[model samples]
Target: MKPLNLAQFHLLIIAILLPVFSMARPGLAQIPKEASQIIDDVVVTAEKRKQMLKEVPVSITVIDDLEIQDRNVRDVKDIFNLVPNLSVSSQNQNVTYVGCRGVSPSMINRRNPFVMYVDGVPFSKISGYSADFTNVESVELLRGPQGTLYGKNAMGGVMNITTKAPSNDLEGRVSLDISEYETYLFNANVSGPIKKNTLFFGLWASEYQTRGYMENDHPDQDYYDDRNILNVRGRLRWVPSEQLEINLLSGKEIRQGGDGPMIGDSQIRFHEYKNPDDYVDADSFDNALHARFHAKKFDIVSTTTYRNATEDYDVDYSYGSSSVSHGILDYENTTFSHELRLQSPDDRDGIAWIAGGYFEYDQDKDNEMSMQYLPTAMMNFNRKTDWPCTTTGKTAAVFAQTSIPFFNAFKFTIGARYEIVNKEMNYHRTTTNLDTNTVVSSAAYTIEDDWDSFTPKASLDYRISDNIMTYVSVSQGYLAGGFNNTIDDPDATTYDPQTSTSYEWGAKTSWLNNRLSCNLSIFYMDIKDMQVTEYPSAYVMVASNAGKAHSYGGELEVKFRPVTGLILSTGLGLVQGEYDEYMGYGGEAYAGNKLKNTPEYSINAAIQYRHPSGIYTGLDVQGYGKTYFNESNQDNSVRDPYAVVNLKLGLELSHWDFYVYAKNLFDEEYYTSIFTSSIRNSYMVGSPRTIGANIVFRF
Candidate 1:
């Protein structure tokens, strides 16, 4: 990679500061008291308390119901365009990868770097990483390590979503949207009082369909296949007294989609399409319940959840090439979890605290059947079956955090957590004879492992002035160890957990009489026992622990509303990540190598205009620097830097709303994600320009 020269660096800095300079007027703009009150009414639970966003010491971004409705953000992924330091990529519709603060994990088997919480309940299942967010009231993205309060897998950050609750006022809404590229969406929500003083209920449903973007050029074949999703949700809330509230939520979703064509070895020309029989099918269901009680000095919360899913995956390994052929695979998983928390009052002198205990039990099972067809026979060839694995795991943790005011305009926080985890794996593998259509002898293995960890954190925040503050924090995080079902080695069961300690310093300021807000943070992390996966060949994969790694990054975010009806936001991130030691081909030691998918720099900017005449317009742009797709850092297969643009416009009336939007306005041709293998590498391309319109009626 080439380094930026001094002149270029100065030019970039000037460009970033240009907007702020242009908006600097002679007279200071005064904020309306009513508007300030309205903003303060919004509450956030990220700090374990119902506090205003400006009062919290941590860096957080909030998207409320008004923003959600105005932007037509039907899914969680759609919000990425509006936020800074956030990105989402999907392998298919079923698998999604998210990155925050440049700390995402690249290994397929590793758990998500950021923790996800839905309605005060932590989602424990790894598969829940792809859970769709529907009927959501608000979403909060808390940046930095939240190890003390959030426990494990929070090294990067945390995302918390609050769904709409049952309402006593009768209200409902229905919406229909259609767009180019054969995309359709229908959604409705209804809520009202079931009894005078007994109960309230809410119901929501959504159905979406879209055609695939990639083309399959095989003989007698159509373009890329399509995908469909159906979802329904119901919620009930009971408030028998002023001090107690109970909520019950149930949801189910069914998804069916075709896996897009895989990329071929040749890069210059497009590959041929595969037959319809090579498509993948997926279906899943989810259910959950949550309850909370409020008293004079104490509050308690409990949550329980269950989920089940099944998937049938198929791919054309050859990409219509002569060296490879078609392949098929299947998987199924189930999970259950429960947790409880308690919070104490802040009446004590300069002291406020929260403590919680959490427990989760998960059981997962998978079955894989693969077949390799010969080039000549087309439909007949050799077959191999290595499958039937079950995993059972349990995790228990106790954590607490306390905030104390040391002096005027200064506060300190101290927190700690201890966690215990146990996992057991049972596997049974078998081979089937293709000609005889029978299963061969089976091999079985059982293994178990237990782990324990203690993490601690400390933070100090000082209010320099009424409009500016600075904070510093140090925290520890952990990712539990687990057996890899894909490994054939007997010693693969001995893998260890990955742990890290992070240190951060940041400052937040609201300048120009509240017209502009900017935050800057720098962080460094020391990681130990990093777990990584290695693929020596097309069909072989192994899990191993690397010695150590170091990562450092800086992030800057600016939000400016220069004029009465104009808003502008911009963010930038620069990261440097490297592995100190790695085992390369032939077991040779390789050091000082950059990690895959870790880009050096990224930039995002957006502008919005809202006029009194009921017209709203927006423009958003995002750019990512070049990044390596594989650990080996092959030059030819690396992903090139690219930028994308999106535009939106809307009109709001008393009882009706209309919106028109265009994504990928520039029609950029690029890949959002990639999966590489020895036989053939596959790339998931970004969607082409899509123009859509929506109409909604409120009653």
Candidate 2:
């Protein structure tokens, strides 16, 4: 399918929104006079408490259900541009790299600098980060270190997701969407109360299939990147009394798609690979139990969760060439985690506090085998490796905060948390090589390691006025050390833990009778013993400690409601990141290079309008500056700047919603990742233009 002209698409959106403005004006007149002048408040839980976003001292971005639908944010990758200083790189379904404010982790088994939580349970495994977002209520992106409320793996930031719960009224919705390239989707959800205010249940399911835009010129048959996904979730809530509540949640996600990236260095618009066995299959399932008890002055909460996941894929290692090299990789993981917390009353006037304890156990098994079919010699070269690892960890922390009202107009706040984590891992691996079904070499090894660390955080916040607030904070973050998967050398089996100290100041203000809001923040980070993954040979990759580094950046977010039905929002970020001192292969120095996958600057802008007649339209544009994909910072490793535009339109009747959306309207050719390994370059490109419409029915 060919893409439409960019100019025409923009005109179409503007025409639809502007031409009917006069006709919609009468419907707008029916709105209550006071409602048109009132701007709704946005509530967030970044600080572990429900508060107005403008009152929170930390830097946070909230995406509500409306924004999620208008922007077509299907996954985490889709929302990166919506938040300042956020970026992600995905080479395939098996591996994804995420970063916030230039603080990214090495591509290995080490813990990620950022963490994600779904419905109050931590989703720490990278393999399960791509879970379905079918019934999410809201997403909160907390910037900077979050060690106080959360423990390890939050050095860069945290992403917390809340899913919708059952309501008293019987509600259900079904949706259908169709787009170009034989893409289709079906989604349905139902929720109702089983016994008025005593018990409730909710169920949701969705399926999506698409024939992606990758053509194979070699064979007359289709070589497109075919993808299929299925997701289902169920929830049960019981509130027997006003003081006690219990919840049970379960969900699963299944994703299957083609093997390797569809594009390389050549922008020829077609993927040409001779190998036919190229595919990836991944899935995950999770179950969680939560209970809460409200006391006279305090509350007690507990959560227990179990998760299982698997990722298996086969790819052409030759990059569509005739080298006859291919690879098969597989992983299976299971995890069990539990947490308990106590929280003070929310309406307390003087001081409030919270304390929590957490524990988790994980088991994983991985397998990889590669082969080269040498047609010239009628021979086969093969290598196989299998790994089985287990990890156990326990974390204990106590946090407290107090607010003092001074002169009735100003308030001072101070918060701190002391956390200690103990973790152990056992790694065992075996590798074998065979030539023409005869074993040429074999090796087996086993290793075990234990690590412990203490992290503390403190912050001070002050309010200047009822509509203005500012604060400064200093926080410490840590990532646990672990053994590397590239177990070629006995001595290079384990890497040290990574730590960081961050200093930040921010302000949130509302002006023009709360119709306009602005938030700004600047931060600096000092990092030590950063984990780095390096390729020492054509087939050998190892993890090591890179000495030290520093980074500084700033962000600005603004939202304004010009008129009753028009809203405008935008975010801008600037970052400067470089290694303070570092040494690489052959004793080479790389002390002055930029950080990998960190963009210099980025911007996201959007305008949305809604009328009383249920007509709504929005336009969003996002742009990113140049970024380096490798530590070397060579010119060949840079990805140039690019921008994408999207348009959405919908009509909301009493019981039905009809929507049309266009993503990547200009068909921008952008690369999500580019890296040079073993004198070979690989590139992963972004998706092309997609135009689709969906109709939803609710009752």
Which candidate has the top score in lDDT?
A: 2
- Write model 2 residue lDDT over 581-623, tens digit each, in one string: 7788547677888888899988999998888888988899998
Q: Which ten residues in a row have the lowest lDDT in candidate 1?
A: 30-39
TM-score of 1: 0.89
Per-model C-alpha lDDT, please? 0.69, 0.74
Report the C-alpha displacement of residue 41, candidate 2, in angstroms. 2.0
Local accuracy of candidate 1 as per-residue lDDT tens digits, 503-527: 8888888887788888888888888
The best candidate by TM-score is: 2
Residue-pair clashes per prediction, in order, are 3, 0
Model 2 stretches with alpha carbons more than 4 Å out: 1-37, 218-221, 266-270, 321-323, 367-431
